[model samples]
Target: MKIEIWSDIMCPFCYIGKHNFEQALEKLPFKNEIEVEWKSFQLDPTLDAAQPQNTIEYFKEKKGFPADQASQMIGQVAQMGKGAGIDFNFEKALIINTFTAHKLLHLAKKYGKANEMEEALFKAHFIDGKNVGDIEELVSLAGNLNMDKEETRQTLTSDQFDYEISQDIQEAKNNGISSVPFFVLNGKYAVSGAQPAEVFADALQQTYKETVSPFKDLSKEGGASCDTDGCSA
Candidate 1:
């Protein structure tokens, strides 16, 4: 079974969703058979990467939320992160453009390290408060994954993988997805938002049954049998 997840690295719920989804996958008997692909989605595609702003301030200024409401919302998200085993430090988190970060992910995908790359990016931004928009920071993260440091730097500096990033974003729009942390299972089943582990587990099991499991023979009586000999009915 294949699962494609469309998410933005800056989105708090995307990290939470990733953790919940992985937790569900860990318990599945056929977990090894599952293929997960992380797709790119930008919540703020036009944000200036050169001038990153505080996450709470960005929410208040851009989204028109009051100061107290913004803090409350961020606090709620932090609580949600804790529930998913993530320590989200919004105070240190910055709102920066993720276009370059997404390109790095595409490069990592070529090396079969996209999942690892996504996890590292999430931790870098939400936990460690690293500037994901910075090429050097991204290269360092890639190096930690054993990816070639120079190749990663070149890829981030140039337009390499930009096409793949755009394609992923366009595909999300084509699928009517305007939100982050959206999951598509077997190109059919979709679970939106940061749902609980049970929801993901149920979706995974259902998709596996429908797509990978053998068909059931519902015939009560033996209707026909054919082997290397004559058929019987």
Candidate 2:
């Protein structure tokens, strides 16, 4: 079975959704048979990378939320992060454009390290509070994954993989997905938002069963059949 996840690295729920989805996969017997592909989505594509802003302030000023409401919303997200085993330091997190980071992810996908790249990006932004938009920081993260540092720098600096990011975003729009952490299983099942592990697990199992066994045997006894022999009943 194949699972394609469309998410924005800056989205808090996307991180939590990733954790819950992985937990769901662990509970499945055919976990090894599952193929997961990470797709890119940018919550704030027009965000200025040059001028990084405080997450709370961005929410208040850009999103039009009151100061106290912004703080409350961020606090709620932090609590949700804790529930998913993530220690989010929103105070240190900067609201920067994730376009370059998504480009790096496409490069990592070429090396079969997309999953690892996604996890590292999430950790950098949410936990360690690193500037994922910076070339140096992205190259460092790629190096940690054993990807070629110079190639990573070049990829980030140039317009490489920009088309891939655009395609992913266009595909999401085509699929009627405007939210992050959206999951598509076997190109048939679509699960949205930061759903619980049980929801993901059930979706996975149901998709797996249907993909592997699409037919139901309703007959009490075998009908006439032909194999190597001419015919048999």
Candidate 3:
């Protein structure tokens, strides 16, 4: 089974949800058979670097949520992350145009270091307070993962993996994605939101059952919501 996750690097819930989903997969019976492919979904495709606002202020201003409310939300998310064994320094986060990050991710995918690069980016932004949009930061991340720094820098500057990023975005649009942390299981089941770990575990167990017992019957299901357009058998 394959799990396709459409998520953004700067989205706190996406980071927390990633950890929760990973934990669920770790304990599932069919863990070895499942393959995870992280898809690109930029929360801000048109972020102007000139303004350069912090993430908390950005969300508060954009969503009309109070600053205190936003802080509480981030605090809850960080707590959830801690429960999942990941620490999220929501304070140090910056609003980044994730297009270039997505491109670099695809470049990392080519070298089979995609997961490492994703983890590095998450750490860089949410933990280390690094500027993920900068080429220097990206090259440093790639070098740490043993990738060629010069090649990574050139890829970031030039049109490297642009096509891949476009295609992934198009796919997300076709699926009617309106949020990050969206997950598609086996290209059949769609789940939306930063779901609880139990919800994610249930999803994997269900997918595993379908894979192991194809002839077994199943039924329509409904949770809080689906990732995009509603999922069916």
Candidate 4:
């Protein structure tokens, strides 16, 4: 079975969802056979990198939520984040455009360092309070992954991986994605948000079994599930 996740680098829920999915995959009998693809989705494509604002002010201003509500949401997410081994620095989290970071991921993917860079970016912004949108910080993060730092820096400044990133975002929109942490199980079964490990495990187990083509059940009326081998819906 193949699972594709469309998510933003800065989304707290995406990190949490990833944690849950990993935990779920760990328990599967066919875990080694499953292919996991991490696709990109940017929350703020046009954000100003030069004027990064604190994430708290961002939620309040963008959503019109009161400070107390925003703080409560942050607290809940932070506490959940601890289970995933990520410490979300809500107090210091900054909001910046993730366009460049998304571009960098495509570059990293080419070198088989996408997951490493993804975790590094998450830790940089949420745990270390690093400015993820800053080119310097991005280069430093890529260096930590043992990637060619100078090449990464040049890749960021040039229009190198923009096409792949653009295609990712466009595909997400075309697939009816409206939020981060959208899990496309076999390109059919989608579980949104930061679902728990047991829930994900159950879905994976179900998906693994349903991969067997259902030509035998020709009279079945219900539409093929997202997990079906040749799902048409």
Candidate 5:
């Protein structure tokens, strides 16, 4: 079975959703047969650069949330993340445009390291508080993943993979998606938000059963068939 996940690196729920999905996969009997593809979805495509404000400040100043509300919201999300094994440090996170980071994901997909790339990017932003929008930081991240750092830097500097990023966004739009951590299973089942691990596991199991069923006695049908006492053979 194939699963396509549309998420932005900046989305806290996306990180948590990833963990939930992984936990679900661990419980699946056919986990080894499942394939996951990561797609790009930017929270702010028009954002040009990294804002000077941290997450709390961005929520208060840019999003117009009250200071106390912003802190409470982030704190709630951080607590949720902790349950999923994520340690979010929103106070140090930088609000940056993720277009280039999405592009790097496309590049990583080509080399079959998309999962690694996604995990690294999420950790950098929410945990390590690295500027994901910066070319230097991105290149360094690529190097740490054993990818070609110079090649990644050149790709980020240029307009490479720009169309792929746009296409991913357009695909999300065509699917009527306006949120991150959206999951599509077998091009049919759609799961929104950071659902529970059991929900994901059930979806996977249902889709797998639909895709491939165990052997059944087709000869014991309602139609005319051969039998020891019948001439309707």
Candidate 6:
């Protein structure tokens, strides 16, 4: 079974959804047979990487949320993250363009380190408060994942993987995906948001069964077939 996840590193719920989905996978009997691919999605593609803002400030100034409301809203998300074992420091989190970060993810996908890259970026932003939009930081993060730092830098410097990132976003738009943490299982089953572990587990199991495609003969009589009673005469 294949699971493709559309998420943004800056999205708080994406991290939580990741955990919830992982937990679901853990409960699945065929977990080893599952293939997970992380797809890129940008919450603010227009934001300038050069001029980053704190999360609270972005919510207040850009999204037009009152200061207190912004803090309170983020606080609620932080509390939800805590339940899923994420330590979200929204106050220190930087709100920056994730285009470069998403591009690096496509690069990481080539090296089979997409999961590591995603986790590193999430921790870097939510916990360490590192600026993911910074090229230097992205290069450093890639290196930490044992990826070729120079190659990663070069890829980001050029227009490489730009189409892949854009395609992912375009596909999301086509699929009516306007939010992060959207999961598509086997191109059929979809689960939105940071649902509970049980909900994800159910979706995973359901998709697995639906995709298995059980063979049905529909014939009433057996025709020269072998069975537990031995070959039919």
Choose the strongest candidate by lDDT: 1
Per-residue lDDT for 58-129 in model 6, tens only?
Answer: 988889999999888988998999899998988789899999999888999999989888999999999999
Q: Write the per-residue lDDT of candidate 2 for residues 161-198, one digit (tens) a residue.
A: 99989999999999899999999999999999998899
Off by over 4 Å in 3: 49-51, 217-233
- Rank by lDDT, descending? 1, 2, 6, 5, 4, 3
Which is the better candidate, 1 or 4, if ranked by lDDT? 1
**What lDDT would candidate 2 get against the real structure?**
0.92
Report the lDDT tens digits of candidate 4 across residue range 1-233: 78988888779998888888888999888998888778989887777867787877998887788999998999999999998777788788778888888877888888887777777777787778888889999998888788899999999999997888888889989988889899888976888999999999999887777885534466658775665466555
After aligning candidate 4 to the native by TM-score, how far in Å is the CA of 25 from where it should be? 0.7
TM-score of every candidate? 0.94, 0.94, 0.86, 0.88, 0.92, 0.92
Q: Write the per-residue lDDT of candidate 3 for residues 128-190, one digit (tens) a residue.
A: 888788888888999999999999999999987888788888899998998988999998898
Candidate scoring better on TM-score of 3 and 4: 4
For each candidate, the alpha-carbon lDDT, in order, equals 0.93, 0.92, 0.83, 0.84, 0.90, 0.91
Across 1-233, the per-residue lDDT of candidate 5 in tens digits comes to: 89999999999999999999999999877999998999999887766575545887778767899989999999999999989999999988988899988888888887889999999999999999999999899999899888998899899999999998889999999999999899999997999999989999899998888789745555755666677787573
Looking at model 4, the pairs that clash are 188-226, 189-226
lDDT, residue 84, candidate 5: 93
Put down candidate 1 lDDT per residue, 1-233, tens digits, no spaces: 89999999999999999999999999999999999999999998989988889987898889999889999999999999899999999999978999999998999989999999999999999989899999999999999999999999988888888888889999999999999899999998999999999999999999999886557768879787888988988
Off by over 4 Å in 4: 212-233
Every model's Cα RMSD, please?
1.9, 1.9, 9.1, 6.7, 3.1, 2.7
